[model samples]
Target: MRQYIVLSDAPWRSVPSRTQQLSARFRGEVLYFEPPGASKRSHRDPGRQVRPNVILYTLPSAGLLPVGGGLARPGGWRRQGAFISRAVLRHGFREPLLWTTCPAQVHLLDHLTYRGLVYDCAADWSRLSPRWEGDLAAAADVVFAASPALADHLSPCSGNIALLPNGVNFPMFCRSDLDPPRELRGIRGPVLGWIGSIDERLDLSPLLRTAREHPRWTFLLVGKVLRNPLLAALQALPNVHFAGRRPMVEIPEYVGCFDVCLDLRRKGQDIYEIVPRRVFEYLSTGKPIVTPLYPGQVEAFPDVIYGAHGPEEYSLLCERALEEDPAWVSQRRKDYGAAAAWSRRVEEVQQILGDIGLA
Candidate 1:
């Protein structure tokens, strides 16, 4: 059977990242490795079987060293690399596809061998470790970029980079049968929902002003709110609801409660470069989406998604999304979402591999 060794950035238990989703769909025996644990000691467990063909393993502790650039301490990674090598041999994995998400973990290449290397660039890691990321991309047989911006950024390192944007599990989000989560029951007005990590990347000003302007319209945000001063003011609003992180399975249910979905981005940032994962999920539900006038969104799904300029435009777009969406438009959104499903994304990757003679 074909085999894969995936070096994941996120743990298997966390809300499914791209690595987890793609690995689950790969038709082979997958030996998935999570990032090193906090403890200094190595793990005793062999591995955990998350799926019938996917076995999850956590790398032994790599110490509290800064894991960036080529100058990082080798002692920790050497040990971690040794552990991974042993796992590979124990599982009898021969010439497995090496799929790496983290640039810091590239040191494992020193101790492991693989048929082909696939660098999955989900974000721009240039600031984190330009040297390490550059070397990885340059050495990769194929590079998969999550956005057009990322593809452009990595073009200098590799000539074989492919644009593999974030995708939604279409069937899960497209289900119209889900009942709204209980947390949304008390919301009084049209729900303007947003999901994913609530962090500094968010432009809370639009949400704040919009929430205040429409006191009855609930701005429902469902995710972990990181440290941001603007959140305090948003929390003060009566209509702004912050539902903390829920299980991945429950996201569709929460999204079902939303009348209009939001894709808010911080101002002064390269908003055009970003392709939020939640946008695809929103599209899958056929919900009207209001986001910044990102060229990527406008160009890709011009008819399906609405783009706005400033706070006033943002609010107006939300209102228009709620008021203007027709039944046929909703179906078109669903079709767009289905076209970008993870299954189809994987097929695209397979085709790229075949063209490059790696498959």
Candidate 2:
């Protein structure tokens, strides 16, 4: 058994990722810290129990150490690092398998004691500085990237980086035996669905245009919606239903009910290389998908999904996807998700740990 300390950039409330999956595999206990907002200190300290051996807590930031009214002191990097150190010790964590997904958490290296540290580069965090990137790479026993583009991006900081793609829970998502989620039972089909953050990265235009062209087709979007004009437009459309955020356990049932799925990422240099998690999740269900023609999308699902090149064909491709036989499509991509399961991906991570003499 091993003890692990995981510092995360995503809020505890968000969807699961590689960091969470890795922690789940460890036989020992894990103290997982959640990301704080804008350097503010909240009074929360429950350390929510996520699994049998894993607990989660949000850290404090120096910028917002409330002073009853407004009296902020030095809650800078050093102070925040010290705060984190104390928290780690408070949970009886010492010399554990320390991992961080956030490059900004590199500062914790200066204050905490750990047996080994691994930097998993799964996100393109905007606030990360070049100095921290180098610091993290130098300090990390292993640095894993979620994509080929990400591995190349980190090549400047380290020569020894591992390519670790994001994975799905295959059995949970790929099976068609589960009944449709109760929330989706009454919703009309020719149903189109999408799951993940409905943020700016999403190209809402395709959904808007498709819904307008075919009002009878009900579009189900399940995820948190960040403020955007496109979201407002989608909300106004009578055919679109925003299910909001649902529990992770219910996600598979939600996707299982879909006649088809959509992956519409906006065109930009920022996320041109991102292989959205939903793409793999939808693939697990063997549901036919329609997406934008991004390089990553084209490479990952060339034969599996319908890629629309221009705005003129977005709705047309979706219409065509509805014609695909679900059972045939499911069988075609049946083994693909098995190779992309989180368990298989973490097995590789365990080997990395063994190779580095940490196991």
Candidate 3:
């Protein structure tokens, strides 16, 4: 099996990122590098091995500043170099495939040996530091994008970019045996639900207006909340319920209870690069989805999700969504969800690496 050394800004345990999913399904060994300040707890030298197949390496970043050339600067360079050298040394300096989500990790190219470099980019390059822009333009031998929009955004920087959208853990999110979590037992339906980070991505205007427009419809919002401006409006609405982060296993149960799943992420450039994995999960449950008109979602799932133009259209779409033929929608969603399974995505990655002679 081919071995891969990974570098990502996301902590493995926290969000179960794209890198984490890839590692879990990878046919070979995956070494995941975790720097300080990523998680709440600080890790010492010689990272922790959480799984037999994956290793989490923790080393000091020596205060690697967030801007351009921070990783190459005097203090940052030595620390980053030493950590990568020692980590590679422990593995006898094998020539493993290098995979990273953040372009900033490209600094390791100066210190380690790799058979080939792959950029697993999930967000727009513009959102990253200008320093990494040079690395993105010159360093990676191959690039994998989580959405087609991101692939288009990175196309100018690299000719080898691939459109690899997010995949879902099929059985986990598509549980056929359904029991609504007891926490949601009291909420009366026709439930309109959303599952994802409750942050700036969510447009408050539409949700507020919809809740006010339909007092009888219970609105369920599940996920961690961050930098939200209209938390007050949600709090005031008795019809709106916020279920904080639930265990990964219970996500389907929580989602399955919904009559219609809502994807209310604000429609703008911030969303252009992201194709939420929850869309697949929602499809797995065979529930109708109402979301804003996003280019990424439009590209991947054109007729699958109910795309609305504005707040007023949200209620209208939700009504239409609930009225769709369940038998037809269920079978179609099941087929789509199964086709976009994580295993299929992983196999596609394996094939790509093989085609490039990296696997």
TM-score of each: 0.92, 0.85, 0.91
Tens-digit lDDT string for candidate 2 (121-196) = 8877544466666778778888998888888888888767888888887888987788987777788758898887
After superposing candidate 1, which stretches have Cα over 4 Å from the reference?
63-68, 266-272, 294-300
- Ordered from best to worst TM-score, the candidate numbers read 1, 3, 2
lDDT of each: 0.82, 0.76, 0.77
Candidate 3 TM-score over all chains jointly: 0.91
Worst 10 residues of 1 by lDDT: 63-72
Give me the runs in candidate 3 sitting further than 4 Å from their true place: 38-45, 66-72, 266-271, 294-299
Point out where model 2 deviates above 4 Å: 37-48, 64-75, 87-94, 266-272, 295-298
Error of 2 at 112 (Å): 1.5
- Residue-level lDDT of model 1, residues 233-276, one tens digit each, is 99998788889999898999999998999887754555336576
Clashes of each: 0, 1, 0
Candidate no. 2 TM-score? 0.85
Model 1: what TM-score?
A: 0.92
**Backbone steric clashes in candidate 2, count:** 1
